[model samples]
Target: MRWAGRGTEPEAVERFYAVIPAGGIGSRLWPLSRADAPKFLHDLTGSGQTLLKETWDRLSPIAGDDRVMVVCGRAHRAAVEEQLPKLEDRNVVLESEGKDSSAAIGLAAAILEHREPGVIIGSFAADHVIGDQRRFRQAVVEAVAVADAGYIATIGILPSEPAIGFGYIEGGQKLDVPGTTAAYAVTRFVEKPDLATAREYVESGRYLWNGGMFIARADALLDEMAKTKPQLVAGLRRLAAAWDTPERGVVVDEEWPRLEKIAIDYSVAEPAAAAGRLAVVVGEFPWDDVGDFASIAKLQSGGRGSDLAILGEHARVLADSSSGIVVTDRDRLITLIGVENIVVVDTEDALLVTTSEHAQRVKSVVDALKLSGRTDVL
Candidate 1:
């Protein structure tokens, strides 16, 4: 596998444009990352920078402002507008409704296709956290170069641990292509595995975490889409044809609801892999999807301490609060004397107390609350 480092130069990249698909409601990270404010807007890293801002910062050097586009749902228009003041009002493509990743990418692709031909596109989720931004950027730069050569490419994360939360890519053998630093022919893409299977994948040394990062020319993607999932591609093509027309953007909002909800991974990458048409590039950069609260617990002190006061553990008395996450709601005293493995969320009107282990299942509670018509709790 190929590893990347800061400022490590690769082959010159193609004309690059980035599409960030951020339509998720983030029900899993409820108290902090709500439907109104998803995980991308929150400071999950404890670094004071939001996930989308960090992603924008890392990608800015390569694609720059004019080429960077954000695809978010209508519910988050104001929040996105407030956060990214530099972006033009039109650059933010507001989905009339939230369908899924397939529709989001299709919308972004339609925009890019109209803007420029032979454009290399890097589409990624906004909430994922990449540790080595420079290396990550370098790896993307390399992937763009590979894409320019007419192959659908994705950045496959080298499995650092037996992570059950992530999908894995198998059958990634090193390639001997010219001017290629590290490209692999993807044998297959596996969905999330059981613990035993995950352990085997990590130990096998032939698997990589499917980090859900994709790169390819817009035309190449459309071509693959046409070949693999023609119905979805046809709908997107119709959308692309009418994206810029005055009547389309303002009046054709109804058509989007009819669009199929599919993921780029399922519709494009998996088929390509099965047909031996997909290229998986080994990425050296550290990555995480940051899906739910359990991941949050892992990020904070490896979820070890109950009395693990994040901001001020040593200064104050934090006794018998072992295995509790004491996130202060206000600038008040947060002394947890007796708590264990609970997530203490301090929101304005809501306070959630959930065990760290079952934090990922919080979305079910949110769904149930919605079913009960209790918008007050949600």
Candidate 2:
């Protein structure tokens, strides 16, 4: 892997720790992604290994088998452990409840900082699909170099299209960090915009899709948390101080619930970017967050103009002059004759039938089910 530097400065080769926060329910990808068994537990890519396992495999080469940590919910602890057998019990940080990305990542960082003062920690999601492993690794290496220079570095994926679903990161002038090329100062972070704004951003070529991947020193991350969210930092510090002690469970149970529910993007990233304490490394690798069914269809179809796409094993799907996607977990044939641009998710207990255009609104269905007291399907 080639890396760009200012001069002949030696590359920062330190022990890197990868902290994966695997706590999302992925409500949009319902049926397949449920409360008891979230999306990360299933092999959405049909690669035999689950998404959590894939994440572990992807990071193992860089962080070593032992240095990689996972922060997940208490309910999914068994599943995470089953998928990642190499992960130590100590390395699997458990959250009492879902507090959001900030708490999950901050807790992991605090524990890592306590274990090793200067450990470089990179937070990558458990459900993201990353193509071109070499390019992804190259970007991570560069991000680590930028992080070593004491900036919270993020990998900003080069936008492939004007997608209104993902946020954007506006990049500023390039930084003078050594052993890096394409490291830029982050101008600002923008939320998911309308199609018109997204088109403008793509045409301007100054924005990158926010991939939610961040790399920085454990201490640096904790320090930023201290500044932006002092209460969160205090609680995490208390938990980290007791992480390996006998009172760990008691401390977490008492403190975790009181921590504010906030995302890392809002609690740290955006604030840090505003204060000129953030850097973005342009990542051109193919990446997808697999947010909804439409994204899954795109991945399965290989972005081809196929009228139909199927995701799952033993799915005897037969479509005639129809354009849609079908996912089946049952042992039966699914026939689509004339439906166009539809999405059919067939599970044992629940089957979801909706148009692909409404893929982003599947979360509403989840909410409706909750209101109707249909927790069995949820």
Off by over 4 Å in 1: 1-14, 302-321
Task: After superposing candidate 2 on the true structure, give the runs of residues whose Cα lies further than 4 Å from its correct spot.
Answer: 1-13
Candidate 2 global lDDT:
0.88
What lDDT tens digits, residue by residue, belong to model 1 across residues 136-206?
87678778877877778888898878988899998566765555687888999999998899999989988
Residues forming the 10-long window of minimal summed lDDT in candidate 2: 1-10
State model 1's lDDT: 0.75
Q: Considering every candidate listed, which one attains the maximal TM-score?
A: 2
Q: Write the per-residue lDDT of candidate 2 for residues 1-378, one digit (tens) a residue.
A: 122341333345455889999999899999889999898887776677788898888887777778889999889988888888889878998888899998999999999989888888999999989888778877888898899999999999999899898999999999998878989999999999999999999999999999999999988988887898999999998999999999998997799889989999988899899999999999999898989888877777777635688878778888898876888887798889888878899999999999878999999989999999999999
User: How many backbone clashes are present in model 2?
Assistant: 2
TM-score, every prediction: 0.89, 0.96
Structure candidate 1, residue pairs in collision: 306-322, 306-323, 306-324, 323-341
Which candidate wins on lDDT? 2
